[model samples]
Target: MNINDLFLCPICRNIPLSERESFLNGLNYHLKTYKKGAFIARQEDPVEALYLLLSGSVKTEMISDAGTVLNIEIIKAPKPLAPAFLFAENNRFPVDVIALEACEVVFLPKKSVMLQLSSNEAFLRGYMAFNSNRTNFLSERIKLLSIKTIKGKLAQYILSRARGNYFTFEINQTQLAEYFGIARPSLARSLSEMLEDKIITFKKNEGEILNMNALKELVVS
Candidate 1:
């Protein structure tokens, strides 16, 4: 994608021409590419620049006290993350971002972005709305992780994927365990239980949804 097309304001997916010009004028930002598995940013890194994913995928993660990497979220192409932190009082990144595939990104200096936001009402409003949505998403994720039982967590996860559809996204057992912050064996046992209960079924390398209603009941029970 052209860098212009990729220029999504973190607060709003689209950037108005006036706002875009103002941003470009303030920050001498440029697009750069990173290979898969490359570290885009490290935790607690100085909030130097804001990042916008132009192409490919990225994952945000944090290291726990025990030094285990806890995956936070997977970001797809054309999405923006982490710019919100620049405007926050902390001005520090809470998690690390890694490229999951060959990725292209746009980076703008924090000072430049803030300058533009201060003078631009439109950009400021978009920025605030974006942060609000991000906060809500994080709140829901916290709720998901609060479930006591592995089976309950898995059920809720599967139901979330199904959402009114019969197809669920394919994810390997290892990835599932990592995403849920559970041990491999515990995740395996939970999956077996879910399969036995007819809540879900799986193909060799794909996901299948058996009963969404039953999965919801399992999550709540």
Candidate 2:
């Protein structure tokens, strides 16, 4: 699909890129399709381009020296993550990005992005705001990972999804395991415990939400 037709700037879903011609035209950009499970870029690789996901999902991960793969974050459709080159000090990617499904991405060269940002105040503001939000998200994820118990982590995750009085979304066991950085069996045990405690509910093929007040109590107490 043409970048213009996509309309939604995958990085900032609420903003349409068609309105940002100065930013779009200044960059040497190309649209590329990636197959499911394709590696978009590896950890420590030079940051040459900023990618905007046009379709599908991607996961960011890092492998430790002990060969343990730590799943850093998952990028859903219509959002972008880890545009490392926008920062002067981030010359290389700190984690690997892999397509979770067949996807299309628009790649904008780093040099062009820097040039455009230098001359366009509006684009600069938008880019800065994006990075600021990213910083806050990373901070929260770090805090979540620091929680020692599986139940505590699960409680935090559910609390994050709770909006007003409702909480529901699609997620599978494998995805949950990846997000929690634990084995599937361990996640299963934790999930079962939560269900038994009446902290949350779920069904096969359907995702889950929480007993919000119960979840909050678990999180605090």
| lDDT agreement with native, every candidate | 0.76, 0.73
| Clash count in backbone of candidate 1 | 0
Clashes of each: 0, 0
Instruction: Work out the TM-score per prediction.
Output: 0.69, 0.73
Evaluate residue 106 in candidate 2 and report its C-alpha lDDT on the 0 to 100 scale: 82
lDDT of 2 by residue, 28-144 (tens): 889899999999888888777777888889998999989898877788766555764546486787788999999888877878777867776666666777788878877877777
Worst 10 residues of 1 by lDDT: 5-14
Off-target runs (Cα >4 Å) in candidate 2 are 12-19, 33-38, 56-59, 71-78, 99-103, 118-122, 200-217
Locate the minimum summed-lDDT window of 10 residues in model 2.
10-19
Clashing pairs in 1: none
Residue lDDT tens for model 1, 1-221: 47675555455445577566655677677888999999988898877777878888999998987999877878887777686777668877889999999999888777767786787776678777878888886776677789877888887776666645455646787877876778999988878877887778865644677777777777778
The prediction achieving the highest TM-score against the true structure is 2
